[model samples]
Structure formats: structure tokens, C-alpha cells
Target: MYAPQEDTELLAGALVEEPVPPGADVLDVGTGSGALAVTAARRGSRVTAVDVSWRAVCATRLNALRAGVPVRVRQGNLFDPVRGRSFDLILANPPYVPAPDGRGRPRGAARAWDAGGDGRLVLDRICREAPALLRPGGVVLLVQSALSGPEQTLGRLRTAGMKAAVTRRRRIAFGPVLRDREVWLRERGLLPAADNEEELVVVRAELPV
Candidate 1:
């Protein structure tokens, strides 16, 4: 399971700023450790956290219990376990790293990162499906590396008829994963040859009332 990192904290900060009404239905997609889910629960929202890894689901459940919060945790791919359901708010901190060629579908813990060549393997799907899961006036707060193309996410959400914009951004130095893939990323023009930092962005898209 993926642990909370800079991306997770960035998304969590955005969640804190959001106005969540008591009893609001909140979905924490790709919830690795249930951090965001618990945060919402603490605010009086009914939280449901989903993660593809069963381990992650268990961790979230345990964490919520330890925190004295109620979080309905599920194990499944994004939005699969909650099909036909809508939420007042959705949070995602998906895999946004651009993986090299010959890397097939991520297995085990690698699923937390290792997105496809352009790094939109999971991101594109979220853009297409998340809007449908959002109720009227609902919002989606997604954090991803700029290397994956934040503009692409913004365009896709707007195309889906949501009011979308980048609400937060941060420049963090390349972590071990990115540092190892530095050569490939530079070759793909996803990163600058001289730059050692990657910009993380939180995109907020809202369904109109």
C-alpha cells in the first residue's frame, strides 16, 4: 500500500479548505491509508474509502477505528465498488508517475504508482468517470504530478461539463521513484534536463447545481 506523501498531504490540505456539510456523503477514491476519509469523517461527513489493494482497505479500516471515526472502507478499483452511487465530494491521489516502456500493468505495491508512458493510465479514467459519480454541486479534488499533464485533466473535466481549475500547486524535488526514471522522463520531454523538481497540482472540478 502507498503511504501518505507530499501528494497526499497536498490533497488533504485542499480537503480541509473545502466546505463539507455535516452528514455529507464523501468518497475517498484510491484511499491508501484512509487519511482523507478519516478527515472527512471527523468533519461529520459520512465517509466511504475505496482502494484496489485489500491491504489498503484493511489499513484504512484500522486507522479509522483507531481514530474514533466511522469510515466504510471497500476494496476495488476506482469507483467499481461504489457503482451507481453519487457523492457530495470525491478525493483521489492516484498514480501519476510516468513509467518506462515494457512496464505492463502494475502488480502488487507498484500499483500505487507506475502509471503508463504518459502517466495518464489512471488519471484519464478518473476524469471520464468521476463526473458521473458526483452529485449536483458536488466536487472532485485530485492531486497529480504536473508531469502527467495537469492541463489534460483540466480539459477533460471541463469537457465533461464541470467547472474545473487548478486550485493548488507545489514544486517538490524528485523522489526516489522519479529520480530513478529521470533519464526516460527527460527523453519523453516530461521533465526538463536541468530541472530536479516536479510540480504537483490539485485540480478541483465541480458539478453544476
Candidate 2:
């Protein structure tokens, strides 16, 4: 319904620092409001943007028009429409909030933030699937909450044959969703008994030519 939050901004900040070559081919997974897609286009990279939500696709299209940046927008699960294609750079700010089991992949407001307990449902798949879509010497900039286990993301990307690391991290007070789930998050050992902040991390995974 709206653009993403601090996590998205943090990833955008981190991405602005990467060395994207001129005319680089870039993919923005979960393009949402097309913020990062616009950024990539503005930086002179050819951009392709994707999201599973119809609203997000429309938002991305509108945002791109407003920004005067051309973005190839598609509605599909992560990487599906782009299968068999590789890119010089990829960006994602996926859902990483830990939620209860049996809560199937959401389709409404919660779809933008809710992931299964442990918060790796989408993250793990990204680690497993993204490396294959990177051209040599390419990179994927992924952002997630530390509660989802950045180490796990790092390890999985490395195992998938990419060098991955946390390049940026910031802690912020719980948003409304997290605040609402505080009790369950605490019970699941995700949030500390006395802690009210969550850390967001940008994971940079790269392939060597």
C-alpha cells in the first residue's frame, strides 16, 4: 500500500555506494514502490523490477512514470519472470518479520512484512536462488532483519558460491507490526525480554569474474 521503511532506505544507502558499471543490467526484486528501481535507472543502469503484489506492480509503474525513469515491471514471485536471465546487479528488500506457523504466505497488508517464524522463509530462498542469477563479477544487495539470522544468509550465499557479508546494519524501535507481535516474538526467543529494538542488515553477496 505504501513504500517500505528504514530497512529499504538502508539498502538504498548501501547500494548507492556499490560500483555499478555504466550500462549495467540491474534487477530489483520486490520492486515495491520502485524506489530502488528508480535509483538504479537514475544511476544509468538498465533496470528490471518485479513484485508479487498487484498493488506493488502498479505502484512501481506509477512511481517510475513520476520519476521519469524507465523500468521493466513484472508481477511474479521473486525471480520467476526473470528465470534464465542473469544480471550485473540485483536488489531486494524482502519481508523478514518473524511470524507464527500455519500463517501461510500472506496476500494483504501483512504480505509486505510477515515471514514465517525465524524470518527466513523468503531470505533463505533468495540466498539459494539469487547467486544463480548473477553474471560474473555481479552483485546482489539484500536487506533483512538480523533476527532472521544474517549469519545464516551469509553462510547460505557462500555455500551457493558467492562471497557474502553484512555491509550495513541499523537498529530501530519495533514498528507497529513487530510491536503487535512482541509477545510472540519474545516467546520465540527472537526478541530479548528487555529489548524493544530490531537490527536491520544489508547483505552484499558478490560473484567474481
In model 2, the worst 10-residue window by lDDT is 103-112
lDDT of 1 by residue, 24-143 (tens): 999999999999999999999999999999999999999999999999999998999999999999999999999998989989888999899999999999999999999999999999
Clashes per model (N, Cα, C within 3 A): 0, 0
**What is the C-alpha lDDT profile of model 2 across 18-128, one tens digit per residue?**
999879999999888889999999999999999998999999999899999889999999999999999999999988989888888776877788888888889888998
lDDT of each: 0.95, 0.90
Pairs of residues at least 3 apart in sequence or in different chains that clash in candidate 2: none
* Deviation (Å) of 103 in candidate 2: 1.7
Q: Show where candidate 2 strays beyond 4 Å.
A: none
Flag clash pairs in model 1: none
lDDT of 1: 0.95
